[model samples]
Target: MAAREILADFPAGGPRGSWPAEEKAAELTRQGQPATVRMDLASDRFLVVPVGERS
Candidate 1:
């Protein structure tokens, strides 16, 4: 297994759904970091990580 570096995290309880996480990933991508979001069911949060860094 590979280790994924987390760039950011958003709570799953956000009223705006996953929009904030998506937007953050997009902003990171535009900034040249190339990020994406993944759900952590156990922790109940959205994780922002670099592309290809899926756990």
Candidate 2:
């Protein structure tokens, strides 16, 4: 898959209607990677994964 990142002040999880925060975290972990943060434009909230935990 293509590595896509937000250029705006977006968070880490995933894009809107793209993927769930928890699901992204799981996917990253499954891929031997880790997640960091997430931004919900609709909710105007940020989802942050703790260090060494989610990412």
Each model's lDDT:
0.91, 0.50
lDDT string, candidate 2, 1-55, tens digits: 4443531233444566764556656666667665555555676745535334321
Give the Cα error of residue 39 in candidate 1, in Å. 0.3
Prediction-by-prediction clash tally: 0, 2
Q: Write candidate 1's Cα lDDT for 1-55 as tens digits.
A: 6677999999989884448898999999999999999999989999999999857
Which prediction has the highest TM-score against the true structure? Answer: 1
Stretches of candidate 2 exceeding 4 Å from the true structure: 1-19, 36-50, 53-55
Best prediction by lDDT: 1
**Candidate 2 whole-model C-alpha lDDT, 0 to 1:** 0.50
